[model samples]
Target: MVRARVLRGVDLDVPAGRLTAVVGRPEAGKTTLLNCVGGLERPDRGTVHIGADRITGLGDSALTRLRRDRIGFVFATCSLFPTLSVEQNIRIGAELAGRRTEKQWFTTVVELLGLSLLLRTRPSALTAEQRQRVACARAFLNRPDLVLADEPAGELDRMEAAALLGFLRMWVRKLGQSVLLATRDPFVAAHADRVFVLAQGRITGEVERPTVESVMAAM
Candidate 1:
């Protein structure tokens, strides 16, 4: 295995309004790459640009602004406040983006995520699937330019994964939001318009979907 690097000169472009799936086996440096791009971690080499803004080189405060104002993330873990209601969690994101007064945007995200019925429920009261959906809704509530999701469906069963992936596809298409998702599951990649296969921190191949059985076989 190659020794870890801060950044490994991997260049990627995620166009607007597209869902790009990044697939790699265990320990393929998926989270590292995401952290660099998301401005959560600084890279030793190379630059990460979200449109014209270079995220990798930004100072801590600037990176925080970039992430909060322009990007969103969904992790495998539920990072929402346990004490806050689902709607409040979602609303906070919008508030940060200065859109808290926009009822239309709030209602749109809630309706799209089917969270109207669960608005009052706290994170502790929700099931895993419901919590994940709320996470999704919270990420979209701010209308971010890009979203980065790591291992989003790793814990869900096949049926639930399919449903969640489909909702992500719809979210990308209808909201004009771009997404980069990292997963090991072929089913998750099946929902993306394109897939990049990573191995030992290098992109070994690219596959376009709806994938053929032969394409899935390669993974």
Candidate 2:
């Protein structure tokens, strides 16, 4: 059996109230890094921390609780429940955590994501952009300490991707949310406050206040 080291000596931080990004090509361990940080996968060495909590050695139950309470996730796939309305899908996270969705927060999230009119609509009835907006709304509804977005705009058209990234930036600036986004696209990485370039499971460079040209150069 051959054991593959997916991530090697990768050390980075997602600062509070800021959007950080990891830029990497496929098979460069971007998803693996996110999984480890999100506590879905345990690393062979080192530690993971979110705020004051050390998640590295936490039991499954503890990790689950921590993730539920502090972490939000947005992925390439919208992952909305086809059976549920947009509003229902957005509120499901809080429901699962045994927490009631705050009405004001819900309203704000829906409005910001332009999902207000689509609240009663099912996922299957919406456009791809709309569904992804619902996904974003759901992820933000909890106001988690950190959001992990893996290739979140991969499925969107250029304009749609720009819009989504703009909203993410707005959340960081307005709501003071922290985001860690992973992507292979320089355009995506350019939206981040700080961008880490990953190659062959290692962080090869970092660009602060990245632009597309800068990120491309780093890559």
Candidate 3:
């Protein structure tokens, strides 16, 4: 594997079932940290373990399979196949995991995201917020080991952003899955259970139960 040499003597253990905010300024290496955690990038000096499995040493095929089966992503831009309906778009996650969609999981996701009625609609027919909501539903549908979101709400309006954050909080509380979200937004970072502020490729500070006031002062 081509290990990504980013974490130099850096150490952080994310507790299960919590929303972890990786926050820092531009080029602060927040995205790189998320990539490493999600196995999109391997750590050169340290191993990444998801439970008992050492992810950093996995072969390409093994890593690919691990990512497909155990992780989900929400990029800064909403990545979806516009030609596919909302249902089919969401289906792609489970399909990649090589698991037939669980009916209960799919139904719960659609209802939680209010996408059941829009399942037949195309991506172009929806607003940006709607499109992102579909993406969220898809990511959660598979019950992944970890969810990595890079600026997932960066494009939304204030109200939409708040709603998105609340939705993520609910996921953490209800689904019991860990989420690693990287963003530059102070308000968004405020919602996390723990906030790690990176600077010059190192974690400069940390705030437990992050808030806009606390995180801003750290930055």
Best TM-score goes to which candidate? 2
* Ranking of all predicted structures according to TM-score, beginning with the best and ending with the worst: 2, 3, 1
Candidates ranked, most accurate by lDDT first: 2, 3, 1
TM-scores for all candidates: the values are 0.93, 0.97, 0.93
For candidate 2, write residues 1-219 as lDDT tens digits.
998999999988889999999999999999999999998899999888898888999999998887787888888984888888888899887888888887887898999899889999989999888877888888888889898998999999889999999999999999999999999999989999999999999999999999999999999
The CA lDDT at 33 in model 3 is 81
Backbone clash pairs for candidate 3 read: none
- Model 3 residue runs over 4 Å out of place are 1-7
**Considering lDDT, which of the candidate structures 2 and 3 is the better prediction for this target?**
2
Give me the runs in candidate 2 sitting further than 4 Å from their true place.
none
Comparing 1 with 2 on lDDT, the higher-scoring candidate is: 2
The Cα error of candidate 3 at residue 135, in Å, is 1.3
Tens-digit lDDT track for model 1 on 65-105? 87887788888876788988998887776666565447877
Error of 2 at 97 (Å): 1.5
lDDT of 3 at 19: 94
